[model samples]
Target: MKKYRITVNGKTYEVEVEEITAPAPAPKKETPSVSTIEAPKAKAEPAPTPAATPKKATPAGKLTINAPMPGTILSIKAKPGSAVKKGQVIMILEAMKMENEILAPQDGKILSIEVTEGSSVNTGDILAVME
Candidate 1:
């Protein structure tokens, strides 16, 4: 037999263990019955369909740009009506002590500028619109 002390979360406990020399008892076995009843079958159900998302309708000729992460708008390089190419950097964002370039998603003119220099923004916050 052995004894030990244990502490957990500011709580203390004492434990003891003893060696066994006797053999373990044999497990019991059951006989199968000759006459068994079967369970009733359940009806199959149809799978549920996912609900359609309601789209945010941007003005017909315009599009909305959202922030990719939480950050401060460091600078704006595009103004309203400024022509931009797909993947062109329109703004600089500072997030997590790193600078990130917010780019135009498609070749289009800047329809509107929603954020200004030094403005803090969260993920998915609209930054600008291009069309």
Candidate 2:
């Protein structure tokens, strides 16, 4: 076992790790002959149709806010049609156990929010649109 101290976000944590060793190989066992049994055939089924989900339309010539990293949305601080200032926190995203603030790029009115709380998003994924 090995012990180590780690620091993250100005916090320190002590942890212990256990090392594992490979075990010896097991002896081979005899298998049943293929000719002894006959397998039944399976019938193919059609794939189920997905439910329709309504999508919000984005206006043209609007600024889009995108996620900077892959994470789950923790909370939304602003709503659609709300006015926001530059550098204002619009939402919070939880990534790698860290809460990252999603800020507005510029002063504008939010046209729409693309993601809800608890939704997962990846880098470059659109989070909202503003005018």
How does candidate 1 fare on TM-score? 0.55
TM-score of each: 0.55, 0.56
Off by over 4 Å in 2: 1-58
lDDT of 2 by residue, 9-121 (tens): 99999999998898979976977667656678878888898665444455678988989999999999999999999999999999999999999999999988999999998
TM-score of 2: 0.56
lDDT of each: 0.89, 0.91
Error of 2 at 100 (Å): 0.4
Write one digit per residue (lDDT tens) for candidate 1, span 4-103.
8999999999999898989999876977679878989978888788665344557887889999999999999999999999999999999999999999
How many clashing pairs in candidate 1? 0
Task: Tell me, by lDDT, which candidate is best.
Answer: 2
TM-score: which candidate is best?
2
